[model samples]
Target: MYREVPSARVRGAVLWWSTSPSWTTPVRILPDGCMDLIWSQRHGLLVAGPDTTAQVGTASPGERYVGLRFPPGTGPAVFGLPAYELRDRRVPLTALWSEGRTRELDERAAYADRPERLLESVAAARLGEAGGPDPVARPLVARLDAGGEVARAAADLGLGPRQLHRRSLALFGYGPKTLARILRMQRALSLLRTGVPAADAAARTGYADQPHLSREIRALTGLPPRTLLTTTP
Candidate 1:
């Protein structure tokens, strides 16, 4: 079972937890322009970076995982590094923080009944020290997710194309163009989950057509639309 709740301690973040049953299945984690700080019963503490493609993950039966997912541009502030450095990777928390800090966090998580809350608290404290996420991050994501053209969005944000690209790399681990594509795919997937036909979902979400949608989905997820839906949360 899996569940997520909006984080009260950290703005624009979610706290989630999941437990594997006696039987295990591969989980498809799609790219959604976010990074996660995770605590696992089996793996200890880890960081999940933004992905350019879907990630296939599995767990030992009966294992539990708790995570705090930070929105695009929010993670760098809390993690104290550029988002691009961790893109498409999952690394031990010790890799990003000093052993002393990592060990303290591990102890806290081990003693907390709800480790996701601990993850959120840690993120909140770090983000406060960093003076919070970039002010442009939320607006940038909103503009791209709404299907605004990258150039126009940059201009609207009072940024030159190069400036936007550079900032995007640091904030989202990719350029605005790729982020837009991933956000559009997420929109299409949401529509599909609600029983929207593939063709209609494509058109509504700005794809050229059904085939265009199919191709994009397969490229990003390595699966057909139907298969992808079966694995989606």
Candidate 2:
């Protein structure tokens, strides 16, 4: 079972998902250009970084997990480290923060029924120390989702290509082109979840055709578009 809850406390957190899969197989996590603050019953707290390709993972049978999925550009700010540094990796909170802090958080998470809320507090504290979120995050994602090309995106935002790439790597764990693709994938997934035909979803979401959409989806998910539609959420 997997379900998501709205985040009332953290800005740019798309949602918090709780999962307890049957553990008959490893789950293939898709590329969504997002980072998650994850808590595992067996592994404690960790950061799941932005992924460029599908990642396979599994839980021990009967174990549960709670994760706060933060949209692109939020992770760097929340963790006080460049997002690129953690790309395609999952690291324990202790590796990023002091042992004392991770221990405290692990204890709280072990007790709370909705432990993901405790992570919101952790994000809040980090944001406070950093002053606030980067001003470019929302607009950057908006432009890319609107189908702007990377070079054009930088020019429109009055940023040079190198500067834009640097900031994107720091905040999103990749360059603008990859960010744009991932955001588009997210849009395609949303449309598929709503029962839209793949060809129509592709056309509406900026792909050239159904095959184009299928290839991209397969590359990021290791599964074809139809396979993904069955578990759209």
Candidate 3:
């Protein structure tokens, strides 16, 4: 079983999920242009960075996991590192933070009923410590999420294409074009979950056609729409 709680405590901290499986299940996590702080009985506390491709893992039977997923470009703010540095990687939290700090966090998670809330609180505290995330990243990401092309988005932000690309690569673990594709795929999937036909969802979300949607989804997730939907929330 898995469940999530949407939170309002921090900007870009979308939601948290807890997972408990009765069997060792095959897990396929698609790239969502976001990052997650995860705690598991097996891995302790760790960071799941932005993935350019689907990540394959397994859920150990009888073990539990909790995760807090931050919106695209925000995880780096909370972690105090560039997202590019952690792209396509999962590393122990202690590698990024102090050993003592992560050890305490691991200990706390071992005892907490819902470790995600603790992770949320820690992220919130980090926001306060840094006086908040970069003011520009939010709007920049928003424009991209709305399907704006990279060149146009850069112009709108008063940035040159090269300038925008540099900042985007540093902040998002990829350039604007990749972020746009990821967000668009996510939007298309959300529409599909609402019972919109794939063709309509594709058109509504800016895909050239249904086949275009299928190709993009498969490219990013390594699964067709139906199978991917079963795996995602």
Candidate 4:
């Protein structure tokens, strides 16, 4: 089965797998700035982003996998906007395959060969260094990080609530409120992982109560806070 490890840096999550059973259709997860390295017996190696959700069907039986996930601020420095957008749609790495740089990834997956080598090679290509924050996204991320109320944040940005909603959708594929919620939830998860009590984590992360935190965490991660933090990656 698939297994993962939390990154030591705490800015990201990492996962490693030895073997796993076949999975069904793709599962959709929310957008975030993380990358993955997937290896399989039938498909050798693939590196992907965390902004998109992916179907697990392509993985073959008896394969080994390792994934490195980059946190939000760290993301723009790695994969460019195209890769980020591609990952946002859960598209496969091979779909965007190129000749010189990314070809080795496709070839390795097809041949079921040593994936780590390909992982190192492709990572060295430095695709993440291309883009900067979307102009519209910057203020929103800043406001959210500063613990500003959603309505106030929008107002301070000189955007009406509805205008901010539209801009967030155009820029991040989600509304501002939804993006704010995700950012809050991510902060809560980080706090909880670092030994903060559930109640305290909720308050510090701007949740009204423990149940509020639980509900949001469940909505974003498909699991409750305790399960999410305690469960091995």
Report the number of the highest-lDDT candidate.
Answer: 1
Q: Residue 40: error of model 2 in Å?
A: 1.1
Query: How much lDDT does candidate 2 score?
Result: 0.85
lDDT of 3: 0.86
In terms of TM-score, which candidate is strongest? Answer: 1
lDDT by residue (tens digit), candidate 3, 169-229 = 7778998899899989989999999899999999999999999999999999899999888
- Regions of model 4 farther than 4 Å from truth: 1-89, 97-131
Question: What is the C-alpha local distance difference test score of candidate 4?
Answer: 0.57
| Clash count, one per candidate | 0, 0, 0, 7
Least well predicted 10-residue stretch by lDDT in candidate 2: 16-25
lDDT of 2 by residue, 76-131 (tens): 88888999999999999898989998999999999998787798888878878887
**Which of 1 and 4 is the better model by lDDT?**
1
lDDT of each: 0.91, 0.85, 0.86, 0.57
Clashing pairs in 4: 1-19, 4-15, 26-55, 44-109, 77-128, 78-128, 79-128
Q: How displaced is residue 139 in candidate 1, in Å?
A: 0.7
- Give one digit per residue, the lDDT tens place, for model 1 in 1-233: 99998999998898898988888778788999999999988878999989999999887899988999998889999899989999999999999999998999898898888787788778888988999999889999999889899999999999999999999999999989999999999999999999999999999999999999999999999999998887677
lDDT pick, better of 2 and 3? 3
RMSD for each model, in Å, please?
0.9, 1.5, 1.5, 5.7
Once fitted onto the true fold, the runs of candidate 2 whose alpha carbons sit more than 4 angstroms away are none
Candidate 2: clashing pairs of residues:
none
lDDT per residue (tens digit) for residues 1-233 in model 4: 65556654323335455554454323334445344555544444454544422223333444455555543433333444433354444344554445444556556545645444454444434533344434555667778766788899888888898887776654544565666776787788788888989999999988899999998877777667776666523
Model 3 alpha-carbon miss at residue 233, Å: 3.4
